[model samples]
Target chain A: MNSAAGFTSQDSATRISVGDALTPEDVSASSAVAAEDTARYALMLGDDCLILAQRLGNWISRAPELEEDIALGNIALDLLGHARFFLTYAGSAWGKSEDDLAYFRDEEDFRSCRLVEQDNGDFGKTIARQLIFSFYTHELYSRLVDSADATLAAIADKALKEVDYHQDHAAQWLLRLGGGTAESSRRVQAGLDAAWPYVEELFADVEPTERLAEQGVAVLPSALREPVLDRLHAIITEAGLNPPEAKGAFGADRSGRFSEHRGFILAEMQVLARQHPGASW
Target chain B: MEETDRNAPTDQVPEGGVVTEDPAEHSVWPLWEVFVRSSRGLSHVHAGSLHAPDAAMALRNARDLYTRRNEGTSLWVVPAADITASDPDSKGGYFESPKGKSYRHATYYKQSEGVPHL
Candidate 1:
């Protein structure tokens, strides 16, 4: 791969975005340590992205069209990048690495809300799941940009821009699917019906984040409920479908205990890392 | 690898493409030509083509296909069907008409007499 076109290897390597910006690497290199509560909160956010990213990654080659495959893959990578940032910062409090937090953790140890762990049923269902989570995350990160913790603020600032696009992508698909045809509308509505019950878990104001929110280091998830739901209902109506009226499912908490899909997701994700513990290319 | 019926499900189209039992579900999306500007103050150049349901989806698909590696600062996706292109068969016709017509060149006019910014 030596350069025959006159550019040096150094130029090739250095031509990547050489801007001063927050990255997972930058987070890892800093002397900043997350307080115990902050670390736990970081894990909750990180685990959400990590698990959902795996779910989205399954669509790489399976999407209906080639263009959609790349679109989903890009989003999966964006979520994975956010996961890296949060998990890396969370690891700082415990002297572990991002990989350690991501791969070595057990299902019950995870703090991610159930909304992200839902199956990607049809494309309609996937977009339905995406619409809820993206809208919720977009709202969460918008307020988190002003967090008391500098590290959390920086991470939120960086992740928000991507989350903005994620919400748009989900919304576009939602509108298209919900308005395309009778069958299309029906399936997407079914998707919303299936996903709506889990929406409550996203705003539970979980233990660590609840305390952090009081200290102004985290955005209170409960505060996001009305706005997110209002927007979701408006968009669903605009798409000509009734928003689901189902109650939030029974164990609407981030406990990971009631989640039927989390263990199955983790087994597939963790098997390779466990089988070949320090293996690398 | 041997080729088999990659799409034979009862719900899928029998032969055309990946549309489903919904007979009105268009099998193939329209193609779009994507143009990307590498940075500001630069004209967009053709990057590639992709299939999308409409103009908005075309723009997004263009973004995913062409701008993945920081290659673009802006994107433009035009419906491929809408663009009127010069005939490739015109290589020896109209395009060649201006090529060898040296009188059409401004280079022949040795710089304007007193044009300051020419």
Candidate 2:
């Protein structure tokens, strides 16, 4: 519950103490003034992590095993930490706090991709989604460590280590479920097919992200598609599973327009917050 | 500490042909003991125990359970069965000698007070 380090008074007071929270001193003076594009870019990454964390949290007591419960819970907590930091930083651009942004925003106002918004179908399906997303995040965050924006770079530096472990967790699960039993292999393949269509939305070039990438404040999503896909392809092949040939969901915009599952997710997540505004435990 | 006969015969098993349970039939994973090193001065202390199928999963589980609050920099997970503990009944015989050995303590050397780095 340590206060996030580098944030100003205007930033959300949410306590997110993962690896050293970016203190105010960590952010360069030039990076203090967040551009409109930078804030929007942050929103995209933050929303993605926030929604995925919520989905992962659903597996706390319901995972296939107890050890898996702890594993998923840890990953969910780490994602929540990343989400809090990004949302706090993004909120600083306007007068909004993290709570105001997360709880008050409507479904269309969220900027997360369809990959994260997809429902956690089963253990295998969740693993499939995690494998894809974690691989993408690993590549994205690895590049983001060199960002011109110091705060973003610092966040990425801490996030990269966590994402590496997350990637390994998903990969291990994928291999086990893919090779363990005939029924398990079938379910895992089905899970991969179910989640494959949403992968394309993750690498789509959005205007705000593209603009920020030009300024060296963000990594370009389109630039990450090839390497991430290559790594995922290798993992899927090594797991003895056939790569799904399903077509990507077309023309789906992450900025406002979301998948059908997002509304239900938001309703569950934002319900208590919207119900009792300004109430604290 | 008092030493009991370590090779004492067990009375729990009677002479009658009683059914012995096989350990392999149990499907549960083996337990692992977790130790976490919090800082430079602190040794790896026993955090808790968890069940995992293998060493890799045990280490990962240890990380998830013990280090959630950023409590440690390093972790060590050993199979619970690998550890050997002294019999609690033999505590008196094992630990008795160190009790009155004030000469073994650095505080016993009172004349070294003026030393820079005793």
Best by TM-score: 1
Give candidate 2 misplaced runs (Cα > 4 Å): A1-19, A23-31, A255-258, B1-26, B87-118
DockQ of each: 0.46, 0.30
Local accuracy of candidate 1 as per-residue lDDT tens digits, B17-52: 654454226578978999999888989999999999
Across A158-252, the per-residue lDDT of candidate 2 in tens digits comes to 88889999999999889988987998888889989999998888888887887888888899988998999899999999999988878888765
Count of backbone clashes for each model?
A: 0, 8
Per-candidate iRMS values, in order, are 2.2, 3.1
TM-score of every model versus the real structure: 0.87, 0.81
Candidate 1 lDDT by residue in tens digits, A52-86: 99999999889999999999999999999999999
How far residue A32's Cα lies from its native spot in candidate 1, in Å, is: 0.9
Q: Residue A64: error of model 1 in Å?
A: 1.0
Q: Which CAPRI level is candidate 2? A: acceptable
